[model samples]
Target chain A: MATRSRALLPISFVVLLFLLLYLGLYLNPRHESDDSPMIGKLAPEFDLPDLIATGDRFSRADLNGQVSLVNVWATWCPSCRAEHDVLMRLAATGEVPIFSINWTDRPDSGGSREAALLWLGRLGNPYQKTGDDGENIAGLEWAVTGAPETFLIDVEGRICNRITGPLNDRPVPNPENRQEVRNNVGNIMKTVRKMVAGEGKCLTQDS
Target chain B: MPYSRFMNGLIELNKGLRMMQKQLIKMVYLLLLLWAPLSAAAPIDSLIFETQLQEDRFKQLVQEIRCVKCQNTNIAGSNADLARDHRMKVYEMMKQGKSDDEIRHWFVVRYGDFVLYRPQIEARTWLLWGLPLLLIPVGAWLLLVQLRRQRVQATEEAPVVGALSESEQKKLDEVLK
Candidate 1:
């Protein structure tokens, strides 16, 4: 019995060590891409002036009673430019309305409403309404770390999932975006279709 | 004539001295007027505080909160735009009469516990906060067990002190003879 217990100790210790090492490997790269704590919480409220259509306003009220996408974009961010095509395609699908926050388009940040409007005009206006968040007040309230972060809001306006990087159609040529573009539509459309089907669920990490 | 001349010179000197004193006081008042607006005016950032305590709280909060855009740099140390926004956010919340804890909760909710350098003792973080304390007793117990084993071995290996060996006793008896 003594010898048997003694043999079990090192085996258990080795197993525990492997378990810890496994967790370390998984946890190390995750801090920079941590899951949004905003999941399952109500989307932060904002009343922003529209970017192009100057007289119009986009607020939390706009997102109400609809499962839609709130995208954070800035001309300064290159990833946002990359995601633009995907956004246009997504908008064309007419599956859901995409409300955009043209985040931090002030001169200091090297982005302006003109630049945003010009970009949208040249490419295509994919947004339902583009909010000019020049001051970044709404951006700050939304906890936007950087541009090209997209949030999926449920019918009740609770944040279901947040994609930290740009949505892409094909794999982005950049090696850095490999993790972000894993079968793009599978990440979004699968969950979106379910939510539209009245599942009304929030956690999409597994989905 | 000399007395009158001397008295007139003295009077002139006194008048000049009085004028100089008045000018000096006026200059002091002018300087004070310049200083008052600056002292009373809000700082360049307009982060004016009703009390020194609020300013200190703001200072403490920025120091403790991490800038989400940057790795490892606190909001106070970062020059990133997000950091500036967060600083403004801190100022705004403080102005709205939110306490430090409430302000911390605001950030934590938005950015998770990673935002705070000093995390709260919550469900997921209790292990992080409590493990070092828990180890103290565990380590003490292990040391105690090892020490007891060593003591038993020490007693067994140590030479008996109450009596000599038979050969040593014989040698002693012979010496005495």
Candidate 2:
């Protein structure tokens, strides 16, 4: 009993120290959500032929004086479909120009380019312009891996933010699926507004 | 003497002819061996990385780093196609003569320091690197305390063994005798 009692304090100290060490080692990687990868880099330069036949090409130069969101999506991507409403609403805000980069879509793969055109036609064109990246040329240039990824390019043609999933701005959150919400459209707008008002740095590279 | 010389010349001529046939046969065999590969499997002229090291080191790096998509699995092991694509990107960068630090820096530029598996030892990570060193002394002290307790217990139990039974004593005597 005496021996057991004598050893308890050191043992407890060691256990506590180990626990503290592990906690410190493991917990250091997490950061706040608004920390995005595209925050500070110059937006990838692109000049894709417009998909909508709006008689104008979609180019980074066109967005020089405005803050815009470039959403990389495909009709085939279910998450894109899910996030469609959020994008439509964000577009309705009309404060920021929202552009869509349509990625590779096959007919058997949910919706093709024709189907996407039809869907957009029926839904009312929310974007000022759209680019059809059928061969994934823009995707490779932007280092885009898949669809439903969004980037917030500031007025200076610098990529200010990149949200790697679907956006949800509704008060009641959609049931969480495989793609966790990276950034909501509302949050992105708030950040852009703050940056424009000179309230706080928008985590973007100044052109 | 003339007959013997003629016979010797005939023998030399036969030897030359046999040599020529052997050479021809060898040449034909060589041609066949050269033609066999072309006749069968399609020519795979592409460079492929078939070795484990090429795959594992990249995987090891990715597993340690968090996926930008899924907050859990490292980008290397994540089933997310994005994660696979990131692994491929890392591999391609490594091939392009980028050092591990440079690759890490590239990710940091985009994702910030949150992408690193082992966060750099900086103002925010002093405690992380220091904790392992700190545990050593604590572990040693615990071991010392346990060993001392064990020694004490051993010493305390020694007295009980001194009281031997009479039957044991009789057996001992018998063995001695």
Interface root-mean-square deviation, each candidate: 0.7, 3.9
Superposed Cα deviation of residue B121, candidate 1 (Å): 0.9
Off by over 4 Å in 2: A1-35, A40-49, A53-60, A104-115, A133-149, A157-207, B1-47, B50-80, B112-126, B145-177
Tens-digit per-residue lDDT, B39-124, candidate 1: 55332356778899888898899989998999577888777888888988999989888989999999998998888999898798
Task: Give me the displacement of residue A134 in model 1, in angstroms.
Answer: 1.2
Q: State in Å the error of residue A18, model 1.
A: 3.4
Which ten-residue region of model 1 chain A has the weakest summed lDDT?
A: A171-180
Give a tens-digit lDDT track for model 2, residues B1-177: 999999999999999999999999999999999888555522222334557775566556666666766765577546554555566677788778777778777677656677787788789888989999999998899899989989999998886557679999999999999
Chain A TM per prediction? 0.81, 0.75
**For all the predictions, what are the DockQ values?**
0.59, 0.23
Off by over 4 Å in 1: A1-15, A23-32, A171-178, A199-207, B1-53, B159-177
How many clashes does each candidate structure show, in the order listed?
0, 2
TM-score of each: 0.72, 0.58
* Local lDDT at A65 for model 2: 68
